[model samples]
Target: MDIIKKRRSVREYLDKPVEDEKIEQIVEAARLAPSSCNSQCWRFVVTKGDIKEQIIKKGLGGIVLANRWAKSAPAIIVACADLNFLTHKVGAGIKGIEYHLLDIGIAVEHLILRATELGLGTCWIGWFNEREVRKILKIPRSIKIVALITLGYPKGELELHEKQRLDLKKILFWNKYGNCEG
Candidate 1:
């Protein structure tokens, strides 16, 4: 819970480099996330230095706000999933496709939590141009890019903002969807 509360979408980063061993540990955590039918179709592309810069540029080409923060991150982990491997085993159906995406999401969350525990910061980036990113990374067509994660040591403390959320009383119901005060 400490790691969950401390984790934030950190955009600013220090110039220091993250250790290779720490990166490996973070990846290991992601590898251990539960996958549907234990297919484990996810693959990670770890980028640093010049490669990281190129990916950031290509991925953020259309998003102005994201480009600013992504440029500062010391490393970027692009999560991709082999679509064929995940769905083929399940046969032809939409359920298999859904499982692949769900599995990727779970894996990425595990990565973020592990990074937080290691005193590192990460931001889940979803607004990137996926087609451009695939070209930049030379990712084959067989895989679907799930997300691009930016990682580094935070430049400063995270400031909490007062964001609106649905109250439990309004959202929770005894058994059905519209009933409140159950």
Candidate 2:
């Protein structure tokens, strides 16, 4: 919870490069995330070098103008979902819920929290040209570009501020929908 409180969506990053070992640690966290029916259907593409540049500039720079700052980070992680997972597909069709999407979210959260614990700044990015990203990575049409995350050491000192959120009473309930009195 302390690490969660300390994290923020940092847009500015220092020019320093993140170590390969730290990157490995970040991915390992995602690997440990829970998946529905044990059907792990996600992919994480950690981009750097020229390909990373193309992804940030050509893929997202024009479409998401407000997020151009992501280019400053030393690395970007793209989360992809392979729809070929049979268990999740069957379960989703039967239950009318997309388990793969939920699995991806859980994995991404683990990745972000691990990055924060490692003293790295990160921002969860969802607004981008998905088609462009798929083209850049040569990802098949069967795969989905779930999310993009920017990561690096923050450019300057950032002090933690109180997080803004609705009170627990408004979001949590006992057994029923209007059971907030609990």
Candidate 3:
């Protein structure tokens, strides 16, 4: 809970390089996350130095100007998902549910929590030029790009932004929707 409370979408980052070991540990957490029907489709591309610059230039330009802040991050993780799994495809057709997306969301949370535990800062970036990213990263057309995560040490002391959430009374129910009492 403390780690959950400490987690924030950090945009500013230190210039120092993140240790590879720490990055591995964070991804390990995601690797262990539960996926729909065990269809573990998540793939990650970790970029740094020159490649990171190329990605920032080619993939984050134009309308995604707000994400320019990610340039300060020492590492950018490109989260991808292989949509070749039959279960997710069949589930989507039958139930109109993209289970792979749910799987990716759960996996990303695990990654963020682990980064928080390691005293590293992270931001989940959903806005970007997917086609540009695919071209720059050499990602095949078959895979779906889920999101990008900027990772690095926070610059100076970490100041958490206040998160406003709905109260349990408003969001929770005994069993049915809007039913508070059993």
Candidate 4:
């Protein structure tokens, strides 16, 4: 609960690089996440230095100008899904469900929470040129780029602001869709 409360979508970051050990620890957290049918389809690519600059320049150009702030981050983690998992394709065809995406989401959340515990900050970047990222990172055509996350030590002192959220009574239902009480 303390880690959950500390987590925030940090945009600004210090110029210092994130330690490789910390990165490995966060990825280990993701690796332990449960996936649909035990199909661990998620893969991660960590980028820094010149490669990170290329990603920021060529990949995140044009309409995704809002994410330009990611350049300040010392590391960027690219999450990809390997489409070779049979469960994902079969589930999509049978039930119209993209199970790989759900799996990736869960894994990424695990990574983010662990990162928070390590005093690292993260921001999920969904708006970017997938083609450019694939080309820049040399990711194969068979892999699907899920999302990019900027990571580093946050700039300045941590803020004391409370996270705004909808009340559980408004979102949680008893048994039926609209029932608020059991």
- The most accurate candidate by TM-score is 4
Clashes of each: 0, 0, 0, 0
- In the range 42-128, model 4's lDDT, one tens digit per residue, is 999999999999999988998888899999999999999999988899999999999999999999999999999999999999999
**lDDT tens digits, residue span 159-182, model 1:** 444446687678777768877533
Candidate 3 wrongly placed segments (more than 4 Å): 158-162, 179-182
Candidate 3 lDDT trough over 10 residues, lowest sum? 155-164
Computed on alpha carbons, the lDDT of every model, listed in order, comes to: 0.84, 0.88, 0.91, 0.93
Stretches > 4 Å off in candidate 4: 158-161, 180-182
| Model 4, C-alpha of 155: deviation from truth (Å) | 1.1
Winner by TM-score between candidate 4 and candidate 2:
4
lDDT of 2: 0.88
Q: Over 4 Å off in model 1, which ranges?
A: 63-65, 86-97, 158-164
For TM-score, candidate 1 versus 2, the one ahead is 2
Compose the digit string of candidate 2's lDDT tens values, residues 1-182: 78888888999999999998999999899999999877778899989989889988877877587888899999999998889888877878899888899999999999989998899999988998888888888999989889999989998764556889888788887777865353
Clashes of 2: 0
Task: Write the residue-wise lDDT of candidate 3 on 137-174 in tens digits.
Answer: 89998899999999999986554555688877888777
Error of 3 at 120 (Å): 0.4
